[model samples]
Target chain A: MKKVHILNYGLGNVFSLYNAIKYKHGNVNLLNKKQNFNDVEILFIPGVGSFNQAMNILNRDFKKLLIHLNSNKIKIVGICLGHHLLFTEGDEGGACSGLGLINGKIKLLKKRNSSDVLPNIGWREIKLKSPKLSIFKKYDKHKFYFCHSYFSKLKYSNQSVFSSSYCHNEFSCMVYDENIFGLQFHPEKSREIGLELINDIIRY
Target chain B: MIQRIIGRIDIKNEFVIKGINFEGLRKIGDPIEIAQKFYEYKLDEIFIYDAVASLYGRNSLFELIKKITKEIFIPVCLSGGIRSLKDIERALLSGADKVGLNSAIVKNPKLLKKASKVFGLSNIVATIEAKKKTDTYWEIYINNGRDQTGISLIDWINKVQDYGCGEIILSSIDRDGTLKGFDLDLINFVSKRSKINVPLILSGGCSNYNDIINLKKKHKSVSCAIASALHYNKINKKDFLKR
Candidate 1:
C-alpha cells in the first residue's frame, strides 16, 4: 500500500484533505517531517492563504528537504495557492518568488469589463480537454467547485491537461509533466466526483 | 425584472439544517428536496451554505447536490464549507449553478480573483456575513461569526467588491431567522459603499412585508433579501408581488 504525504505549512485544512484522501486512497499521512517523503510516493500541498506566506514557510522550515525531494521523481500535487507557488515568479503585490516549478508569473484576475462580472465565484464548468486525464479517469459530465482570485497562466514543462473557462479565458485545471503536478481546484472537497479524480491520481 | 428568490440553507453536517428561530425546524430535510421545491415554485435561485462550513472541514453536500441538481431545473448556488478553489470546483461538479462563499472570501480575498478567472464572474456569489454594530454600521464577522475582523461593514463590502465578487449575499447573523425586519442600515451601508453594483441580497430581520417595504423605502426602491420570514411563512409572497 502506497502512502500519500500532505505538506503541513500551518495554513490549516491539512486534516480535511487528509481525511478525504484517506477515505478514498486508503493510506495517508500528515507530512510533519520532510523525511516523511521517503515513504510518501505522492505529495499534496493544500491550503487557503497567501501563496507567498505558504511557500516562505516551506522554504524556511523544510529548506533542503524540499529541494532534495523534488529530485526524487515522485509525484507532487499543488492545489490553489500551492499551484501558484509552483511558478517561477508571482506578480502578487510585487515580484514575490515561488518554488520555481513552472515558468509563468502569477498575477491577479484580469479586471472584467463593466458588463463582465468580477471575482468569478460560483460553480463554473471546466471544459476539460483531456478525456484521458487520470484524475477524470472514472467520471465525466459536470462542473467543479471553485473560489480563487489569482491564477498562474502556468509555464510548466507539460501542457495543461485539463481546463476551465471564465470571463473570456480558459485556465488550466490540471497541469503535469513527469513528476510535478498542479491542480487549480481541490479534488478532496469535490465529493464522490472529486474522489474519482483522487482515485485516478493515486493509481497514477 | 424577475427578482431573485434565493433560499438560505444552514447546514451543520451531512444532515443538519440549523434554524435558530424555528425550534424543531432543525432536521435532515433534504436540501435538494427543498431546492427542487423552490424550482417548482419558479424561484430564481437557491443558496445552500454552511454556517459552520469550515469549523468541521465539511465537504460540500455532494450527495444532496447529486440528487437535487439532477432534478431541479433552476440554478443552485452552494455555499458553506467553501474556503478555496477546490471547494468551489466540488460544488459546481455537484450540480451547483454557482458557489456562494461567505467568510472564505473575507479570509482569502484573492480567492475571488482566482475563482473568477477559472469559472467566470457569474458563477461566483460572494456572501457577506454581518453582525450589527451600534445602529448604523454592521461589523463584518468571519469563520462562522466566531471572530470579528474589526473591518467595518462598509469597508468589507468595498474591499470584497474590489476583490471581484459577481454578486453579494449580505446576511445579518444576529437577525438571521428572526423575522423581525431586514437591516436597512446594513443594506444601505453596503450599497453606498459599493461602486460596482453587483446584486446585494439582504438576509436577516424580516418579520413581515413591511420590513421589505421599509427596506425598499430606506434604500429608495433598492431591493433586499429576507430568509426566515419567507422560510417560516411570516409574510406572503403575494403581498410583495402585488406591490
Candidate 2:
C-alpha cells in the first residue's frame, strides 16, 4: 500500500479528499505543517479557497518541502485552487507567485457572453487531449464537477492532459508534468466516476 | 450550460422531513439514507437544510453533514442556522462543498461580504426565501420563512450579489411543497428584475417531469431543487436524468 498525504493548509476541503482516499486506500493521512513527508508516496493539495490565501500559507510553510518533493519525483496532485497554486503566478486576489512547478499563469475566466456565469459552478464534460494517455481512459468524455473563477493558462499545450470548456471559453481542466498533476475540478465531490479517477491517480 | 437537478432534504432533528408551503412537517426518512439514495440516483447535487436550525440559534447538522459528505461523492450544500463566519468555517470543515446563508445575512448583510472574502466567493451561496406580496412584488422572508423582512425580492437579490454571494437559491414560500409545479411567474419576475449573473437555483413546487421541462424551456441556464416531488416518488432520479 502506498502512503498518501493530504496537505491540511486550512484552505480547502481536506476532509472530503481524506475520506474518499481512506475509503479505498487505507494508508492515507492529513499532512499538517508539523507532519513530515517521510514515506509519503502521493501528496494531494485539496482546494476550496482563494489562490492568494493558499499561496500565502504554502509559501510560508511548505515551499521548501514542496520543492524538495518535486525534485525527488514524488507524486503531487493539486485540486481546484490547489491546481492554481501549482502555476508560476495567479491573478486572483491580486497577482502573486505560485510554486512555479509548472510553466503557467492563472487568470480570471472571461465570459463569452453577458449571460455566462462566473465561478463556473456545476458539472462539465472534459475532453482528453491525447488518446494514448491510458491513465485518463475512463474519464475522457465524462463530466466532472467544477467551481472556480480563475483557470490555468499553461505555456505548453502538451502539459495539459484534459481540457474542458465553460461558456465557450476553453481551459485546461487537467494538466500533467512529470510526477506533478493538477485538476481544476473536485474529484472527491464528483461521485463514483470521480472516486475511480482518484483511485487511478493514486495507483498510477 | 448543464441543467442541475439538486435533491433537497429538509431535516428536523434526526429525520428528513417535508412540509407544505414550509409548514405541517412530515417525517420522510433518515437523512443519510436519503442522501445515499440520491447519490445512487445520480442527482447533480444534494442540499441538506436544517429545517429548524434558526429557531434553535445554531446549526446542528455538522456531524450529519460530515458523515453524509464522507460517503456521498457529489457536491453537498448545507444551509440553516449559519449566523457567523465561524458557522461557515465549521460547515466547510465538515466537508460541505458550499454553505447556504439566509437568516444571518438578513440581519447583518456584512457577514456575506466577510465570508466571501475569507472563504472565496464560490463557496458562499445566498438562499432567498420569498413570499409573494402582490401582483408584481415579493417580500423576503427569514428564519425559515417565519419572519418577513419587508425587503423586496429584487432588492435583496441585487444586494446579495453585490455583497459577493457566489450563487443564489431562490425558493418560493407559496409554492413550497404544494406539488403544483414551480412558480414560473415568480421565477420569470425575478430573472427579469434582478441583475443576477451568477448561477440561480430555483426551488419549490415541482411535481413532475413536465414541471422541470417547463422550467427548462423558460429558463435554460438555471437549475432546480426538488424536495416534495422527489420525496413522495412523484418524480424519480430517472425523470431528472432523462431531461
Best by lDDT: 2
Give me the runs in candidate 1 sitting further than 4 Å from their true place: A115-118, A130-141, A156-158, B1-156, B159-169, B172-193, B196-243
- The residue-by-residue lDDT of candidate 1 on B155-212, one tens digit each, is 7777767766667878777767666677666666665656544656777777876776
Interface DockQ per candidate: 0.04, 0.73
CA deviation > 4 Å runs, candidate 2: B241-243
Q: Write the per-residue lDDT of candidate 2 for residues B1-243, one digit (tens) a residue.
A: 567889999999889999998989999999999998888778889999998999788679999998898788888889999998888888888988889999999999999999998888999999999999898999999988889898999999999999998899999999999999998989989878877789999999999988888898888888999988888889766765663
lDDT measured at residue A7 in model 2 versus the true structure, 0 to 100: 91
Model 1 chain A worst lDDT window (10 residues): A114-123
Tens digits of per-residue lDDT, candidate 1, A1-204, equal 777888877534454466567667778876775454567688888755566666667888877657766888777888777777777887765678888776777777665554343444434455555655555544444555555667778664246777776666567777776777777766654545666677677778
Predicted candidate 2 versus true structure: per-residue lDDT over A1-204, tens digit per residue: 888999989856677888888877777888888577777789999886788888888888887778779888999999999888899999987899998989989999998787788879999999999665686877988989998989999999899999999887899999988899999998888877888888898888
